[model samples]
Target: MNGALLTTWRLWDKIYYRCTRLCYVDQQNNNIFRVVIKKYGGKPLRSEQEVVVSPGDYYVKLHIHNCQLAHRLAGMTGEMRLGLAALKEVKTSLPALAKFVAEHPNADKITGVVGTTILYRGAQPLGFFVRDIDSPLVRWYKTFFFKLILSLCHPEGVARIYQKSDKLVAKRVFMSKRDLLERYLDDQPQT
Candidate 1:
């Protein structure tokens, strides 16, 4: 993002954070996730950890810090390096998130964690369950939003989106609390 765009995005991000009640799991600007407690909408979801999430159930909703992520990924070359860095960020984030959930006052009310992304491949092996977005409007909005972020963040910008348009569709990913705690809490150092 350029100077003006960057400023605008930062302003908007502030407003979005307030509006969504987003909480920073890691308490750092470079942290990958900002989350909010939200009630699940749409159809029921069965997570890999065997938790069933029904309508109105609460879960931690994740939002990627796109601008921070773009900054972290800036100047990197090669798709492999970028992919590996992103995976590392995800892995690095899990411990903090697990600690947050474990200590939350409402942790008992939370069914699990949920996020939507175009980058759904390889998530299953990491304990996430992928599903099609139930709402067409949501799907379209997420596609547009993520693509815009990608264009702004990617080194090649819009070209990369066009070249990989086929795989850019948005999907929902879910991870049960059981999976999150089992995979991250005991082994991960408290952050």
Candidate 2:
């Protein structure tokens, strides 16, 4: 029974990856948006809205941050399931976020999530939290040791920790950004 469940999960995982990768974007400047017409073996899948991004105009979507704590703390089954989804989302998103930040280094007016913290940059610092850096050890970790270890492991990345901050600098930024995000969502036209 356990083996059957494992096999089913693996099959779903394969299907999920294949279905998700159906859409591809071409970055070449000369190409006028090429879309591949793939034929599925059986029933056709419904297509979502198509988006074309121009240079310097890209979308940065912010999903709710759900760490292991968030999943563990969820009391309801639905919440737990959503948290699990969030876990997967964060994993897939972090790499894409890193790639975007790398590709668009000088991107003017680049958008980002107002609520969350940025945990890594392309390999200077190892990890960071935005809320509180009251501890000297955390400061040391963010400043020195983390980067050293990261450089030893992988030098190409500039890892930066943007965890929640109680520090004077981040406090003001987070408060204002979060408020702006909330206001924007509030002002959206109702359906």
Candidate 3:
């Protein structure tokens, strides 16, 4: 039963990778605009908008929004499932991003989430999170000495850990963003 579950998980991971690739390709050809509303109800607002937003930022916003909706729809179930989904999405997208970074030597920098946000030293962002600070994956990634040793022993375990980590981050971010937005809306005095 465990074997069957593992196999199903693996297949889902592959499908996720394919979907991410397609999304990346589509995003490459698309132009995204970030519009900031400076004024609401004829009053000048403090927020400033950027004409272009990075894919990483866009992904973060999408993830946060999804998390909020999922929470609303499934309540606890949404929280559980969405976290898993976010982790899977991030894991599947990372390799392609790494490859893109390698090929684009002159790109600015890539941003990814680790314990905090990590800059990829190029124009691509690799958003990831480690499940446990003491997990082998985190240790291996930080130390870089036991790459071969760790890879040989536990690839799936590492992936799962990172996935769980990302899910936690997503949940936190979703809650915080939702709370802030709610507060902002609440503070607006109705005329």
Q: Estimate the TM-score for candidate 3.
A: 0.24
- After superposition, the stretches of candidate 2 with alpha carbons farther than 4 Å from their true spots are 1-77, 105-114, 117-128, 132-191
Going through the candidates in the order shown, the clash numbers are 0, 18, 8
User: How does each model score on lDDT?
Assistant: 0.82, 0.30, 0.29
Q: List candidate 1 stretches off by more than 4 Å.
A: 1-4, 48-51
Ranking of predictions according to TM-score? 1, 3, 2
Model 1: what TM-score?
Answer: 0.91
Best candidate (score: TM-score):
1
Q: Score candidate 2 by lDDT.
A: 0.30
lDDT of 2 at 132: 35
* lDDT (tens digit, per residue) of candidate 1 on 70-123: 767778878788878877777778777888888899999988889999877768
What is candidate 3's CA lDDT for residue 53? 24
lDDT of 3 by residue, 1-191 (tens): 13454456456645754665222311342212111111112111111332122233312222211221222223223335644544444434333333333333332332221121111112122222212233456444643422222222232435534554433221111111222233332332233
Q: Point to the candidate with the largest lDDT.
A: 1
- Per-residue alpha-carbon lDDT of model 2 for 1-191, expressed as tens digits? 13453456456545754664222222221111112222222211111322122233332323222222232223323424543543444433333333333344433343332222222221112111124334556455554533432222221223312221222121100112222243333332233
Return the TM-score for each candidate structure: 0.91, 0.23, 0.24
